[model samples]
Target: MNENKFIQLLKKGDEKAFETLYNEYASKIYGLLRSYLKEDEIEDALQDVYVRIYRGIKGFKQRSKLSTWIYKITVNTAKNYLKKQKKNYLSLDFNLEKNKFTSKENVEKDVFDEIDYEFILNSIEKLPPLDKTIIKLRDIEGLSYYEISKIIDKPVGTVKSRLHYSRKKLQKIIEEDQNEGNG
Candidate 1:
């Protein structure tokens, strides 16, 4: 179905429409949430995001694309959840050491490959919440600046600047990690 028709069905409280919307967007939303939230909190955050999406669909003004509106709802819902729980957004529990890659057979791979993945993730986790969110939206999710601005309720210029700063921060983190490993 077309987006307009789907949204109209949603506004009318159609159950199938809700299911369809959920099916369409669930994975992306889950991935986005997973980037910021702990494993235990992701499911709750996902539920809250969908609930807010359903409840707010009727009031959606269509000023932006439906997906953008949903993204905004997801970000806001997750942020609100964090605020209510008094959780530190900067603290991510990756537990990379405990969760080693399991392989049935011993496979020889380059050491560089393994280190880079965890190093990059740890670097990103160390970023402030706003920078992390901007990086996820722009770099991971591949959202345009305008879309990210809408989702985060920032101006496009601000989004661009933050994205630039976040990228630089990530680069510095990666460089520091590499230097430490080399030394």
Candidate 2:
């Protein structure tokens, strides 16, 4: 079915369609929420995001893709959650965990990769919220600049520039970390 039709069904409170929508976007929304909320808060935030989507679906104007609209809601819901909780720290739960290794060499490589991934995730956490969000949306979520622009209510050029600067800053942070480890 077309997205529009599915959305229409969602608007009309069609249970099956809403279930489909939830199944489709749940993991993506959860990952996005993990970046903004603490682990303990994630399940609640995910529920809140879907609740907002369900209630707001009728008012959605279709100016953006449904996914973009959903993402915007998720971001706003997370901000609200943070505000309510009065928390200062943000976490990017980019769970790039590796589980299976074949040989000693592969095991060593996996360990190094896990360390590198952890270092990068830590570096990203140090970024300002906007930059962190842009990085998550583009690099982690694989969203286009336009979609990010819509979700964050910024210009496409701004999204592009921020993503560029964020990547460079992350690289510098990683390099500095490596130098310090070596030193």
TM-score of each: 0.76, 0.80
For model 1, the stretches where C-alpha displacement exceeds 4 angstroms are 89-119
Model 1 clash count equals: 0
In model 1, residue pairs whose N, Cα or C atoms come closer than 3 Å (at least 3 residues apart or on different chains), thus clashing, are none
- Candidate 2's displacement at residue 153, Å, is 2.1
Regions of model 2 farther than 4 Å from truth: 95-119, 181-183
Q: Which candidate ranks first by lDDT, i.e. highest?
A: 2
Candidate 2 per-residue C-alpha lDDT over 12-104 given as tens digits, one digit per residue, 9 for 90 to 100: 999999899988888888877877888999999999998899889999999989999999999999989999999966777664333321112
Q: Give the local distance difference test score of model 2.
A: 0.79
Instruction: Pick the TM-score winner.
Output: 2
lDDT against the true structure, per candidate, is 0.74, 0.79
